[model samples]
Target: MASTTDVIAAPAPAPAKPPKRPPARKMVAWLDPLTLVKTGIRSAISATIGKQADRRLLDALAAPDVKPCDVSVDAAGRPRQELWLDYVSDLGDGWNSTYAVAETVARPSLTLRDETGATHETRGGAVLVFGGDEVYPDASLLAYEERTLHPWTCALRGQRPPPHLFAVPGNHDWYDGLVSFMRLFCQGRTLSGFETCQRRSYFAAKLPHGWWLIGTDMQLESDVDQPQVSYFQELAKQMGEEDRIILCLAEPAWLVSQVRPKEGRSYLENNLDFLEEQVFGKKVSVFLAGDLHHYRRHANPEGRQKIIAGGGGAFLHPTHLPRKEAELADGFTPRKIFPSPQESQRLCWRNLGLVVSNPRFGVLTGLLYMLLAWALSVNLGGANVPQALGLVVRTALSNPGIVLISTLVILGLMGFADRRFGRWRWLVGLLHGLLHLTAAFLIAWGVSHLMGSLVDLPFRSLGRDMLSAALIFVGGFLAGPTIMGLYLLLSLNVFGAHPNEAFSSLAIPDWKNFIRLHIDKEGHLRIFPIGLRRVPRAWKRGETAREPEWVADPRDKRATPPALIEPPIVL
Candidate 1:
């Protein structure tokens, strides 16, 4: 026993170790109070300057002659008094929601040098048409401003502030809260988006052309109420019998076909009966509008010519081309058309349009344009032409008559509805517009299919194409000011691009981090784990995990697993 105890009791020596320091992750910093104050002040100043610049154009629009707007009933039963009309010769419609609406007006002074070493200066009048998506995917007040007001705010000013310039609400205008729009501009019921400014949806001023120029708020009941019918009725009486009427519209309602109801309407079909009944021998000299975003000239009844000048800078909506040889005539419909006696107007619609090459504001920036130009130099001229562009041209060239006719019908109806209805009503209107858009796409596709059949393959199945056609048709329906509005309210980022990239780069979620929130009836949010399956590992001892399964001795005190958790269920 003595020998065993001595052998086990042999002593051991001590060892040296390194001293410990603070953790590397815990470094903190201190900043000067003055440095922080200066930074904050600079930030506030920059923000104020930017906001002032944004509002500059709207502020400049204040005019001396354009009386403070107010809507009042008159002896003549006019809802509002006279106000000047603001017309854009060629500009596109609103921009999609979610984009910064930085509308600005820049008018620089031009210098004219004289022979005597003296210079004469003249101010140029420049008004920016901040439109690309005049009508959003949905009709909403925010969308309208996004689509129109904001982007054009600063750019709408002219040199010396033009003596008389007006801005009218477009189709998207009628879709939102007209009252709010009026309030923003300090306008009144007599002057609304649905109705022309401060007048009975009709404003007139002496134009240089000797002819009486009248601007009517034809759509009194469109989204809200369209005065189109009443406005036209009143206009007819107000105009000198010999005076030429130049109708202005955000959407050329009287110019387009039933296939593309910009304002949720269509025109007399190619249904010869409706055409003859509603459109023949009308007294319109010219109808001008700018919603379609392309440029065109149209022929109408009564020697009237319709002008489409929706060439505002924003984005391009694809235009369809038509095919005459493959024309598929349908039965005619009957309807009454204002300014026309023809009762049986056929809805013969074709597709015609041009996609302007823009340098900014979309996927095709100036750099992209230069790249494409360089690409053109490397590629042949034949290859340089856009395939999509040619497809559009082919449809237009094949059935110019149909395209023009369709455009007329749609434009006419859109104009009428926009003039008559309130913008809020456009939720329904957008559906109708989609139907027409679908028809346009089909027409273009049909022409292409027919041409393809004659050359190499058998005729394609219209049946097979039906479903996709319907989808496209429905897609067209979903696009409008209202939809765009919804996008604006819900979208997490800016316009023209997806929201993910911007937020991801910031390393920030639109909301808080991925916290699972729960709330009781009182409405305060609480965090909770959801859909958890695995039981938590237990550790009774001051350790992070349970003991390993392999233990050296079964009877040892350390053999038991640490209790990190107790009973799994919450009582």
Candidate 2:
């Protein structure tokens, strides 16, 4: 039988043809000044909107009689003592992969059967708990409709008794002041083809088998609003000390290791501590979060677990293989569950899809500029290729700043290599950096000399000559320093000093996965971190069921990358 990990095996078989996708949307022009201005405006307004939203949610949750949604009990009015919960986060993209995963979860046949082959019907109707970032490219009503709501609606089509849905807004969700999120998940609007009853962005649900679910709201770096704090405090007052909790934070606290925490105390860490100590005053069995766009688990000897399951459907992020786990303030080491190095290399090609426009616009534009320079050099400028190279070298020699910066960059690259490969790391890094620097210098040199030669062109008309010279200078500027600047950016991203984050266009070991949480009768929590080889290009509604494909062996401490298994049930 074939395994899920088979996708990562060496000499992979050719993939079958995939179904066609919708018309491609343009990538966000992140570098545009107007785009930055809009982002700033949205961010400034988001704090106010988020604050008001927190108040409304807190008020509703504290209505003195808000009943918790039940999933552990059956129609017989007895405790089934087991529950399975489907958790997906950062799942806003309505791409083929997102569609496939969502459809798989929407089906009732995708249930868990126990060791004795007894089907726990209570676990079959697994409730959906979305973590955050429900949309991409910015949160708007239209984006929610097309990216999130539509795909989800497709997933739930033809389903019997629909599953209950709950969500907390992410940074993207707050971009539009939570208007769309409020309508889709909080308002009377239906989430699973049935009207949604959830009134608050944050929720507290009582599960069977002695498990409690608490979802919190976080808007950027701000504190969890006073109303939210008060509501949790009130809930804590009524709770018994013996109860355990499954806390769901929209952002992962473990990510602080990759990106440095803010100076002084960490707001996220402090919030969790406050909830655990002041509010709940009890044991939090596990912390589940999204926002990092990957699947990772970190645990200590004490059995407390922190898991990031952001691969619900967003573009994947790289695993932090070279990150020094021991240096993290929280001493737990995170173990990546998906996209082994081989798998990462396989999926890296997907990054090209992200940048290339429908008609290859970006590539074509770059080529056009290059060709214009070539034409100017050949027709007007008297400089030859050797002359261009000599001019660039002379200019580089005159600028000590470039020389100093390039040396530092090379050293950083060496450090990066040393962390990943122990022996002769310095030499490898030096050679790697030198190669990139040489290429960048050549590009700058040739373009600048060509521009310099344009000053000598003999034009028939004075006005035409002046215009041509100005354009030539501008083109030269772009080809010279501007091109070098781009090269430095690329170099830093490709071989920079960071471990957790990758700035390169395509992040490798790009993890695309999610998790399923199961609590047994005894209240013990088990997590399944599942990975997809890639989007099931052929996945469609009403497909026949197959063997359960497990991505990682939860019990194995030293499992190799891209673990696989074929159990009886589909997960």
Number of the predicted model whose TM-score against the real structure is largest: 2
Q: Evaluated with lDDT, which candidate comes out highest? A: 2
Question: Whole-model lDDT, candidate 2?
Answer: 0.57
Residue 296 error, candidate 1, Å: 1.3
Q: What is the lDDT of residue 484 in candidate 1?
A: 24
Instruction: Report every candidate's CA lDDT.
Output: 0.30, 0.57
Error of 1 at 95 (Å): 7.7
What is the alpha-carbon lDDT for the whole of candidate 1? Answer: 0.30
| Tens digits of per-residue lDDT for model 1, 463-566 | 53443344333333332222222332222221212121111112110010000111223322222111101111111211112221111233333322111111
Instruction: Candidate 1: list runs displaced more than 4 Å.
Output: 1-86, 89-147, 163-169, 184-197, 200-202, 216-228, 258-283, 300-303, 324-571
Regions more than 4 Å wrong, model 2: 1-41, 44-67, 72-78, 110-125, 260-265, 327-331, 341-380, 385-504, 507-511, 538-571
Q: Pairing residues by index, what is the TM-score of model 2? A: 0.67
TM-score of each: 0.33, 0.67
Candidate 2's displacement at residue 459, Å, is 15
RMSD of each: 31.1, 13.0
| Residue 190 miss distance in model 2 (angstroms) | 2.9
Candidate 2, residue 496: lDDT:
34
